[model samples]
Each structure stands twice: as structure tokens, then as C-alpha cells.
Target: VYKGLDIVTAKVTKEEQAQAVHHMIDINDPLKEYTVVDFRNKALSIMDSMIKSKKTPIIVGGTNYYIESLIWQTLVDNPKRAGGDDEDSGLDESLIKVRRIDGSSNEELHKKLMQVDPDMALRVHPNNRRKVIRSLEIFEQHGVTHSEILRQQRLAAGCSLGGPLRYDNSIIFWLTCEKEVLDKRIDARVDSMMDKGLVQELLDFHELYNKDRLKKNEEADYTKGIFQSIGFKEFHNYLILSKEERDDEKGEKLLQQSIEELKRATRKYARRQHKWVRNRLVRRADRQVPPLYSLDSTDVGQWESEVYGKAVDIVSAYLDGRAPSQPALNSVITDTRIADNSTETSQYCEVCQRIFIGAQWNEHLQGAKHMKAVRRRRRQEEANEYREAVEIEGKDERAASVEAEA
Candidate 1:
């Protein structure tokens, strides 16, 4: 109430969103599906606008990756620009310029990029189509590779504020407590959420937006990107429960148990998130990226307020060009359950790209049709290996001499 502003609104949606606004948070639709990439941009835009309007933007929410991605994507001359001209018209429009190509031809794309901007091609992950296609788009348009533009864009994009500050800092505050304390807190939180109609809200949203939303497994296969988010996944499970198992007394009990499990899972998850921020975000003292400074969240009087204050402080320090504090989220390595990969008799499927655990994946590989693919790839791999060996051993030269003598 610093400026005496009235209610803020967040979109609440099955057709809306999981958010609520004092002003109103449920404006975005559940079916529409939100993303970190968009959230980062939106947060930055809002912050910038608030500053210009002389308003102190008090951004309080359970947000993290958006903030991180905004900082990183901004720091790098991401989506490097390349020289492109219409194959028909050599004139380069620069910004709108693009050379579209097939997504399936990764090797061709790689070759094209190496010929165009070898440096960028090397740095981008081979399988990262987002980065690869972006790099290719630059070459297809400008005709000059982004590795070519980096030194120049640095001069042109100039001392821009927000997103990229020549340098930036990040701090991770872990609201840590003993396992028992955390479990108690989680138990309480879950009870509160239930009281607040978190379950009801789930039911409402499902009835409203499921036409647009999808199951996690299906979305995960496509990498729709929200499969890993906590709230999104919970919302998805609610839908799954409705679909797979009908609503009944037994179902209600199972759902209630699932809710408890989810609350516990989220608490465990928060700890893991803390671990990731601590580990993945750490930096060497002299590295170009800033280091992380972290502390226990429970140590503060209030967890939310303390975390928010430190995040703002971290952002403020970045804006002022001071060295950022190095606080990191520690590692919580989930996914520890690796299926038994050591079953010596089992085979790997190059086609499905999945390892058979205890003959499950092996069954798919050994199936008559799939085995045909395995046989083909194995033969090709062997031939490729043999050809490489022959080239290394000067067998190509020897073979040429034998042919000439014949």
C-alpha cells in the first residue's frame, strides 16, 4: 500500500491459471501453459517499467529459474546473428534474415554451421536444436556467422541495462531445517493448502482447461518443458487421477494420500532445488561468470521475506555494477535410481534410444521388426569402424596400388 494501489489480479484458470492476484493473478489460462522463457522476459519487463514509473517493484513469488535464465540469456550474445540473403536476392535485411532448413538433417546443419560459424558450432551442444537452428538461421540470413558478429554487437548493443549487465551476481538462500522440522513444516503447509481449497482449485482448473493441457509422459516425450515444474506436474497428476481412476471413496482416499505424498515430495523437492542452485551455479573466483553466495533460509526470521530481500539485493548489486555475492543452491541429486545397466546379455536399441532394464527395453530390441534395425545399425557401425581403421592404417593407399597392378 505504498502507493495505495487497489487489488492486483492474477489469473485463476482451468481456463485461467494457478495464480491469484490481490490485484488478480488468474488472467493467464491453464490450457495456454506458461514457461520460464516467457516468465523471465515478463519479469524483466515489469521491473523495468516499474522503475521508469518511479514505482518500487516489489516482486514476491516462488520464482527462480526465470530469474536465472533471464540473467544468463541476457549476458551472452545469445541467438548469434549471421549473414543471410535470399538465395534469389543477395540483399541482407539482417534482423529478419533467415535461411530455413530441415530439422532432421542435423549433420547437414552441423556442416553448414561449421562452414559458416565454426566457433559457435563447437560451443553449442550437438543435440541442442534450439541453439543449432538459431545459429543456422543466422547464416541462412546474414551470410556471416554470429561468431563473426560477437565482437561487433558488443560495440552496438552497447551499455544496455537489464537482462545483461556487463557482469551479474546470483545468491541462493536455502531455507534449510532438520528433516523433522522440515517435515513438520511441510505437513502444516499441506494442511493449510487443503484448507485453502488447493484440491478444489485443481478440480476447477481441470474441468476448465484440460482440453489444452496434456499428460506429463506425453509432454515429456516432446519436451514441452513444463513436465519438470512442481505446480504444473501436480496439476497434471490431478488430471491423471480424474482420468485413470474414477472418483469414489477409494479414489478420494488415494487422492488424499497422493496429496500428502505430493506435499512431502514438494518439500523434498525444494531441498533438491536448493542443492542445485548451490552446486550448478557455483563459479570459480576468476571465471567470467560470477560466484554464488548462499545461507540457510530458516536462519532468517521469515523465509519468504528473507529470500525476497536477498534476491532484490542481489539484483540491486548487479544493477549498481558491484561484485555480486556468491550464494548457490546445493545439490540434491534425485534420479539416483539407475536401472540395472549391467545385465550383460541385454542389448541396447539405437532406434528407441532407451536402455532395456531387465529385458524390457531388450524385448523391444529383440522383437523381429526392431532387430532388423539393430542388425542394420550394427553392421553400419562395424563398417564405419573398419573403414576408419583402414584409413588410419594406410589400407586405402595399399588398395589403390593393388587395383593399379591388376
Candidate 2:
């Protein structure tokens, strides 16, 4: 989304973009954050204009939340309280400003949220400071829990989790590749970026944006804007080195390490995308989801038949108001009873010294790490018991011996 993050994002080349119109690309400053709300509003306007001109707006993106914002009525709008009351109407701006200035941690914000809206707290991870603050803001603004607002929306939409689809006649095309194949492709993609002078690109960007910060001994922040890009942060150590140092053995090693880190991060990101598809889109039975068609793209040689051709045919049939020849992937049956209870209420695991929410707690109980921890604790307890028994027995024997001696 940032302008200067061209190489790392693998953004479409100017020549390719010239071939077809694209929206929401190169629209934000690398220094400033571009939010999902901003993207949704702009994309919706673009889609409206396209639809008015009798054109289909094809939404393509890896960011699932951005796509969700376009497809579902998910964004909550904060309205003013009745009677134009200013006092106690919304989150206190002064307090929030103070917190910002003080640099309040995510845990602090989450604790505050837990006090007011435990349900929302449960849904949002404590480490996700942005969401915790947002939920608090919603509650203070509307005089209702953020979770309650969503619950009402879902109730109105007659869905278990989210509101109804913004566009009823929507179709989803999910291109999938085998995990092993996808990992290889991700590694290859990183190598290709390297060949295209990715290092030089990072060097230029750092010189322009990050040199001053490093000189001032400020740590490179990878949580914000373009800095969050996988390749950018992985090269932080190498990027900070003096030109001569960067040319030395240490620099070469650091560069290699960064490259490998980039590859690993990219692969991990791919796995997360797959997990999101499976959990949020495929297996999710709590909401009204659009018909999804899966296309196997494991073999590039068969791309014409398996992916591109199938996608073209599916869209064509949908445009013609005819059922596609291929069967739509089935959604798991909606179990509303279970869905209602799946609010991810916070559950802490003492054995692991970590918190697991809702389904995660159940999964944690079944996980090997948790089991290992449990066994370790059990053995420790047994050892303590045996030691205590032996100590008591020794004390008794010593007393008996003393009496005999006496």
C-alpha cells in the first residue's frame, strides 16, 4: 500500500499496470499508515462507479481483512449519543492523548478493555493494542460493548458471527497450491527479488528514510507502515552497518542471514494465508458466505486448464446467471448453538504460563506442548512428595535412634 515499498511487495510493474486499470496501489506515503477503513471506502466508491458503467470490479488482494471489509457489512460506525450529550459520550480524548504520550502498552489497554467489555477483550488478543483501543473507543462512544454492537448486527443480518454480505451476488475464487509447492515458490520468489537488486532497493529506501533514526540510536520499528514488510525488517542489522562494514565478512554473513530470514518469513506468511482461508472462509459456518470455487494452481504447466481457464468459465457462467459447471465448495453446517459460545472468552493455562481463548484453550489442552508441560509439572510434584516422605522417615528414625542411645 505504501508508495516506496515496490520491490518487497512484488507490486505489479508499470508496464503490467498500464495494461489494465488498478485501484488502491501506490496511494499512500510509506511513512503514513493506510488503514482498512480507508481502503474499503475508496474501493467501494470505485466499485460503484465501475458497476454504474456496467463493468465488473474484480477484487484481488492477499489481505483477507481488506477483502472482508469489501464483501461484508463489518465496519462499525460510531454515532453520537441522544440529546447531543458531549459528556460521557465517547472515549475521553484527553485520557487517550495522555495514554498515547505516555506510550501505554498493549497489555494496559487490554486490561482496561477487559474491565469494560470482557467479551471484546476475549476476542482480541492482548498483544493487539490497536484492536483493544478500538473496542474501548466503540464502547465509550456508543455506551455499549463492542461485542454487543457486533452481536446486534449479526442478529439483524440473521448470521451467527458477521453481518450479511454487502453484495448478495458475489462469487469467490480461491486459488490453492500444495504446501510443499507453495514453499518452493515462495523461496524462488525471494531469490528472484534478490536478483532484481532487492538489496540496493532496501539500501536506497533506508538511506532516504531510516538512516537518521539509526544514527540517533533509535531501534528500527517493524510494527508500522512499510517497515512491517518482511524483507525490510529482516535486513535491519545489515542496513544499519557502515558502508565499509557492510562490504566486510560480517556484512556478507548478515546479508545472507537477512535473505534466509526473508525467505522463512515469506513462507510463514504464506502458511498464515492458507490458514486464514481454511478457518475464516472455508470452514466458517457461522456467517452467510458467498459461493467459493477452488482452483488448483500447484502445477504451473496446467495453469491454463486448472486455474485461469476454470476461473474464466466460472465468472462467465455467473455473469450469464447460470450455474457454473463445477460444484461450489460446501460450507460446514452452521451450528449456531456452538457459534454463539465461540466468543473466545479468555482462558489462562497455568501450566503453559500463557492465555488461550475459547477454542484455543481446547486445542491447547490437546497440544503436545501443553501435555509436556503437564507431565513435567506432574513429575515435579511426585518428586517433591517422595522427598518429603523420605525426610519425614529420616527424622523419625533419627529420633528413635536418639531415644535408644539415651
- State the C-alpha lDDT per candidate: 0.50, 0.79
TM-scores of all models?
Answer: 0.46, 0.85
Candidate 2 global TM-score = 0.85
The regions of model 2 sitting more than 4 angstroms off are 78-102, 207-220, 240-245, 331-341, 397-406
Query: Per-residue lDDT for 256-336 in model 1, tens only?
Result: 666766676778776876554443344212122344434346544675556667666766786788844643322222333
How high is the lDDT of residue 343 in model 1? 19
For all candidates, the clash counts are 45, 0
Q: Candidate 2 residues 1-406, lDDT tens each? A: 6786688889988998898998888877775555566677778888989999998898997678889999999877645322222233342564344335335677888888889898888877787766777787777666788889888887877765577888998889998899999989998999999999899999898887766666677556667657766788899999989999999999999999999999999999888888777666666656677888889999999999999999999889988889889987744334332345445577889989897767788999999999999999999999999999999999999999999999
Shift in Å, residue 143, candidate 2: 3.3
